[model samples]
Target chain A: MLTLAQAQTIMSAALAHAGTAGFKPLAIAILDSRGAQKLFAAQDGTSLKRGEIALGKAHGAVAMGLGSRALHKVALERPYFVDAATHAVGGSLVPVPGGVLIRDASGALLGAIGISGDTSDNDEAAAVAGIAAAGLVSDTGA
Target chain B: MLTLAQAQTIMSAALAHAGTAGFKPLAIAILDSRGAQKLFAAQDGTSLKRGEIALGKAHGAVAMGLGSRALHKVALERPYFVDAATHAVGGSLVPVPGGVLIRDASGALLGAIGISGDTSDNDEAAAVAGIAAAGLVSDTGA
Candidate 1:
């Protein structure tokens, strides 16, 4: 079973890296395997809208069992499915910046990570740092 | 005015602490002026069940002009009102844990923060770090 401690480590590392770089980041979200919220952080000065974007993106990643970027690939591969899903879910499948799927050492369904601030790539980079710091890795199928 | 930088800081600190102590967690949420979600992070192993709770709590906090704890107090004060609101809004008022209103130095509603992990207090503490780190303070409602 994936522990919350591991998730927290991943998130903290990301935030530290982002600070060092001086990025205009806002929120960070970490979800457990069952798609339940495991950890969350919201710094001051962040834009208000960031919360939803972060949740939607992270939720999408966890539910799909893949990173948002990889999920986006599936969307690209099957636009009809992606469009249908997004419409059906009422703006749930937001393939924007700041979303990624995290796994445990055994490649278990630990949860997902989503960030909102600056660009999508920047947010993703910070998230990656968090995961790496936790001694885990993120995968985005190319 | 709250920026994204603070949000990131708060969440990162929370995760670091949580990880060191060891706990299960959920994604963190950050909202902005319009009560819209702007930033988010999903830990690698958060459960899916807690996702809705985190979102609802934060949403309720932002929708109302009170901290979630204050809203909880009001809920106890007027169960009928909170219940009616819950039913009318499809059970959006989650008063369990991990929700706080974001305010400026002058006590203006900048947005809100929501977390799900460990316990309500644990979640709140993590969010607190992000808020304080971001150079903002949360109105804990005393």
Candidate 2:
């Protein structure tokens, strides 16, 4: 099970990395395997939209069982599927670069992290840092 | 304003209440003033459907600026309005008994909490317990 403590650790590390990297204010969301959010935070100056977008991305990651980067690739290959998925998830599917799945040492699916409010690449970098700091593996590339 | 920490505290309390009341496993969702999810949790053994339903209820609470119970009353009085709302919010409006608005000390709107998995009354009870535990007032009665 993905504990709330671990989820908080991941979000804290993500925010710290975003600040250190001088990225724009960010919103981050963490969701468990059931696609239920465990934690979420939007920086003071970030647009309110960031929170929903972050949630959409994280929900998509868990729903598809793939990192959003991978989903982005799939979206590129089958654009129509994106529309279908967005409708299927009640407009919560966001195929983007900042959603990553977390796995335990046994490769058990723990949850996912979604980041927004900066460039997708930078947001993803922060998420990766957070997952690593939490001693979890991220399924971004694989 | 409801900080992410406060949101987490509310959700934790709600789940605890559910456990104490011997309700079925549940999914709880907390939404910010902008109707964005602040935190969510699905207790183990709950169906995945609980996640979306929880979100819908929370979104409905925020959208209508009333607790789900009040919204349900409104729905009963104006069924057509409920249909319109379902279309307007991208179908996230669930005029049921598990959503409650959270407010700060100054009576400012903070957000809303939504819970699902048990009977509607039980879900609302848990939400009320959670809002109280967070030291925030709930507009559930109003």
Best by lDDT: 2
True contacts kept of 1: 0.52
Fnat of each prediction, in sequence: 0.52, 0.35
lDDT (0 to 1) per candidate = 0.70, 0.84
Query: Per-residue lDDT of A1-142 in model 2, one digit per residue for the tens?
Result: 6876788689889989988889997889888887766667777566768787888778898888889998898899998998798898788978989999999989999989999999989989999999998999999734
Model 1 lDDT tens row, B1-142: 4465655566677667667767685567666666555556666555555566777777777766566777677778998887787777667667654687777678777777787767877877777766776677786543
Kindly report which residue stretches of model 1 are placed more than 4 angstroms away from their true locations once superposed. A43-45, A87-90, A96-98, B1-62, B66-80, B87-90, B95-142
Candidates' RMSD to native: 5.4, 3.7
What digit string (tens of lDDT, one per residue) describes model 2 on residues B1-142? 5787788778778888888889998878888898866667666666747778888889998988888888898899999999998898789988989888999888899999888899999999999899899999888744
Error of 2 at A50 (Å): 1.1
Off by over 4 Å in 2: A1-9, A12-24, A32-44, A59-66, A70-96, A106-111
TM-score of 1: 0.65
